[model samples]
Target: MKLIRYGEPGHERIGVQINEVNYDVSAFGGDYDESFFASNGLARLDEFVKANAGNLIAIAEEERIAAPFTRPSKIVCIGLNYKDHAEETGATIPAEPIIFMKSTTALAGPNDQVMIPRNSKKTDWEVEFGIVIGKKASYVDESEALNYVAGYVLHNDVSEREFQIERGGTWDKGKGCDTFAPMGPVLTTADEIPDINQVGLWLKVNGKLYQNGNTSNLIFSVPFIVSYVSQFMTLLPGDVISTGTPAGVGLGFNPPIYLQAGDIIELGADYLGTQRQEVIAFQKN
Candidate 1:
């Protein structure tokens, strides 16, 4: 099942995509948040969709789409999980996954506008594969990692290079800006992706492709990442764990390229779906 959430920004409702058509599943009476995942919601939602197949309303083409699930407790990310991406930035391969956190406020719709934070010049993009936890996990074993995964998501790990590398602090600052974590046109359930490791992921600025790589290049496999992360902290249901990006980020270029207002960023992964965000200047509130 490809899960979706759509409507006005704050009033987004539950939905499911079938045969490329979005269908209303709100009658299932769930918001698809932490509680939903913790209580076997995927299986329940699947049954609901199947039971209401003929009666579900098809969402209009113009409705707003948001991340498939409501904001989780956190958005955990891995840095340099791809060997090529690590080398591109002139860094040694990590002995273990490099973990960082992106603030929940950073969450935005896949097609939402990506705001360049104030006083920023090095805003960059990273097309990454993301995981959605199905249940609470703490010190989970690698062999049991996949059992805790509900599905996968396409993530735009938007970053500010200067704040991330030169600001002398954790990567979270550059990574946690509002609108930096646009995710999901749809969330593809785990069952659909036969082999998650072989999936392809990519990104483009405007019309030209900039990042194109596959999970095959990952230095740490999916199960290892999940199990590894669980060892440090408890991952709640619906938590997002971004698996890191591949090579071709702006920072990798001899002369780094960054985003400017009016730029378009598009990214996608197999089964996980695609995301399209427009770059916009930061607006003061």
Candidate 2:
């Protein structure tokens, strides 16, 4: 099952995507948030789709696409989880997972414009795979981690190098800017993916390929990451965990390239679907 939200930003309605066409399922009486997932929402949603059959209304072709689900309680990220990415950025292999939190307010629709924060010149892009939790998880065993997962998503881990590295105490300063976390044209349920560990992930800017990598290259596996994170804090239903990106971020370049107004970023992962966002200059009030 592929879940989606579509409407006018904050006014979005719940929907389902089947074979590329989206259909209205607002009658299900739930948003894809923590409350909905904690109560077996996915299973109930699947039943609803099965029972509704042809009665589900088809969304108009011109309707806007929002995030697949409502904002999660948190967006936790793993840094330097990929070998090539670690090497490219001049970092050593970590003895433990490097964790960071991105502000929830940074969430934006997949196709929305990415705002270049005012006074910024080091804004960059990272294409990564994201995990959505289905139930409360705390101190979970690595072997049992997958049981708590609801779905997977495509994430663009947009960043500002200056605020993150040079000017900073922590990466969050650069990571939590408005429009920095563009995610999901669709959220594919765990069952849809054949082998989650072997997924292909890629990214392009202005039609030029920049990131070409695979999940198979990850230094730490998904279950380990989930288990490791759960040990420190409870991961609630609807919370997202971005696995980390492979090599080819702008920060990895010889002189380092950065995003500017009018640039376009497109990214996707196997079975998770794709996203496209235009870069727009920030405006002050």
Residue range 239-275, candidate 1, lDDT tens digits: 9999999999999998999999999999989888888
The residue-by-residue lDDT of candidate 2 on 28-137, one tens digit each, is 99799999989999999999999999899999978989999898999999999999999999999998999999989889999989999988999999999999999999
TM-score of each: 0.99, 0.99
Clash totals, every prediction: 0, 0
Candidate 2 stretches with Cα past 4 Å from truth are none
Sliding window of 10 residues with minimal summed lDDT for model 2: 276-285
lDDT of 2: 0.94
Off by over 4 Å in 1: none
Candidate 1, residue 2: Cα displacement in angstroms equals 1.0
